[model samples]
Target: MHVTKEQIAGMGKFERANFINSLSGMKSANLIGTKSEHGVTNLALVSSVFHVGANPPLVGMLMRPHTVVRDTLQNIKDSGVYTINHVNEAMVEQAHQCSARYDSDKSEFEATGLEEQYFNDFAAPFVAQSNIKFAVEVREIQVLQLNQTELVIGEIVGVLSNKDYCLEDGYVDIQAAGSIAVSSLDSYHRTERIDRYSYAKPDEPLRSIWKTQS
Candidate 1:
């Protein structure tokens, strides 16, 4: 169906969110981040983990506008730390529960019965049950008021993973990871890798190099 921007802009917030969400389908890992505080401060789920660069291991995520003051965003602003956890098919139900619209005083970890593993100096608690986890310090946050979204950058200071899921060359076997992929918005699916390739030098006259070298 052909739809114009002006026409789509007329839809309600929920409708627009749904439409955009549908367009995105399943996003990356729906991470649960908690604040670094005296006791457990805040817990929330986000679905926006993305890579920015490889040189310094940078990661990014997004925070949407809050119906009420958002503690996760606020806490990240205050404490400058957060955590990220990967979701598996088995935890989808509980992971989905982490998305509930709870008050700032509420903790989704406690609400969903997910255990938080506290570290020696980690500002935020890690999701102990998750096969993969990351402890990050907020590098910068760009607030895009026009879109009502925040682009947060974090320096990956710590990383943890289950050994069995990794390969010798640092490749991850998705089939063993048992992770789900999202498409168009709310849809979820799995990913599989079927091939590998290597490149050849341009000046090397193709097959004449390897055998003729002798």
Candidate 2:
């Protein structure tokens, strides 16, 4: 269980990738939807989506080296917009299939049988089966020199979710929405609430928000 840097560097490509990816434990699984300038729609499953800032409502995700045809990245660059749809329990299979490398001409929505949805003429598509989704506009794209991976940062412009899942305090109850998490490259998991606590103050006892709210 003691894997040194040398050992890690010497591991097989697939083995190293899985090991490194799983080291981060559970990750948010989302279906990134985009549309080519020519109007071809694309869907890609990405776990790297994360919050960047709250004031500007920014989000970011990493794209693997662009040595190959990256339809989602290209579409976002061309169209300047994309959708992030949470992969819920019901749509896990279809969402995972989106990771497949399909020809740019073929829409993953059609290939996977996932319904495409749009909001107010948004250029990108959303997964109709997802309980929670959001629209993002590209703000920046930086290439990480070390690995050639691209860091795509965007601003969240709109969100779609069931009202019941939106809590009073601005927290979205993703677990209640049946949103699932992914580990490594392929494993899927469901989560349970451990409890919520109030903001911590130095030397102050933590208060259980769940108990007070309930």
Candidate 3:
């Protein structure tokens, strides 16, 4: 555990990757369930979904270098639209299966038991069981040369959720929604909201801490 990284590169590629994976944060990407140009459906698992700005409701996600093999990236490139499905404990198995390399003619929906549903005007299908889901239109794509990941920014057009999951101030309880997170490469976990706070400072009073006296 105390080994230096500079000394590890001499070990090998897999060793370097294993070291990085152990230290990385849990990144859960929103899988974009989409339809290809020829009507072939594509389920692409992504590792990057970030909230860029809230004014216009912008969100960002990155696709891997294999934009060539994944049709979801191409479909969004062509149609400028896609859906983001939240992965929960109940759906993680099926969602993870989507990361596999399937034939262009096969649909992840058909390949897996996970249900898919479409909206009135949107041609792409969204995960039917996702407690929190959104339809997004592609706004821009930025290619990062460092890793060849295409950072895609999108505008949320539609949102669907169970009414009970919403807070009085309009923030959805993602933990209550059962939205899960993706760990480094192939691991998934459920998130639990420990507390909801208004504001805080390092020196501020701590109300929740109980002091013990002997």
- Can you give the TM-score per candidate against the true fold? 0.81, 0.97, 0.87
Give candidate 2's total backbone clashes. 0
RMSD of each: 5.4, 1.2, 4.5
TM match of model 2 to true structure? 0.97
Task: Score residue 47 of candidate 3 by CA lDDT.
Answer: 63
lDDT of 3 by residue, 172-195 (tens): 778878888877777788776455
The pairs that clash in candidate 3 are 28-182
Ranking by TM-score: 2, 3, 1
lDDT (0-100) at residue 127 of candidate 3?
A: 88
Q: How does candidate 3 fare on TM-score? A: 0.87
Supply the TM-score for candidate 1. 0.81
**lDDT tens digits, residues 77-194, model 1?**
8888888777777776677777677766677778888877877788788876777778889899999888878888989988777788776766655446666666543455666654
Clashing pairs in 2: none
The whole-model lDDT of each prediction reads: 0.71, 0.92, 0.79
Candidate 2: worst-modelled 10 consecutive residues by lDDT: 64-73
lDDT of 1: 0.71
* Better structure of 1 and 3 per lDDT: 3
